[model samples]
Target: MSPGGKSAKSSSPSPPANYSAAGEEFIGVDDFNEDAHTPESKTGSAYLEIHSRQNNAILKKNQEESIETINYLEIQSFELLNT
Candidate 1:
């Protein structure tokens, strides 16, 4: 450390307040592209294929369970209202 109370290391220039990693500036509404954020098929195929049946079944089961839970809650609420 220098006796002058300042570090001797060279400092890099700081980015501007509006600087963004996405680009030079933050994305604006006019610059927003809905399709740009959508996933693209690197394989050049339009269809997405799931190679794992076990994973697919697990996801499906979870979805079905969620739907069943929602339905049960709705029924309970209805029954309470009728009471």
Candidate 2:
């Protein structure tokens, strides 16, 4: 028995050394043909795309608003200094 009552033979493998050099194997036609026309899958993908676009637009708008606020503050500061 090893530490914590676990045997040495039950140890997991270490991370691959040359990970970048490995190539992924694609599944064959039989696996690919499965779920060729899934309505739920199509709907989910469309929803994801729309949600992603909306979130991106909201983020851009917030960034633009922040820049405008910063510019307004700078202009006010300049005006105050000139007075």
Candidate 3:
């Protein structure tokens, strides 16, 4: 109830067209418009940049893990030789 004695309308927040809440995008089947080009290009570039960063991070973590494994294996080899 509002102060003016009117019922307030309820609305759910929604993502804009072509985008999902999980950060995925969908391409429309309609014909493309010139005005839509710039925004779409920018959105695609931004999405690519984000994905590239995520991939780089994963690669870095994997490299670190590999280095740790190699160091552990080297230590084990040295211990085995001493025994």
In model 2, what are the clashing residue pairs, if there are any? none
Q: Tens digit of lDDT per residue, candidate 1, span 1-83?
A: 88899878767665443443344753332233333322232331222234356679999999999999999999999999999
TM-score of candidate 3 on Cα atoms, chains taken together = 0.53
- Considering only N, C-alpha and C atoms within 3 Å, which residue pairs clash in candidate 3? none
- The local lDDT score (0 to 100) that residue 2 gets in candidate 1 is 85
User: How well does model 1 score by local distance difference test?
Assistant: 0.56
Sort order, lDDT high to low: 3, 2, 1
Model 2, total clashes: 0
Error of 2 at 75 (Å): 0.6
What TM-scores do the predictions have?
Answer: 0.37, 0.47, 0.53
The regions of model 1 sitting more than 4 angstroms off are 1-51
Model 3 agreement with the true structure over 30-68: per-residue lDDT tens digits: 322323432346556566678789999999999999999
lDDT per model, in order? 0.56, 0.60, 0.68
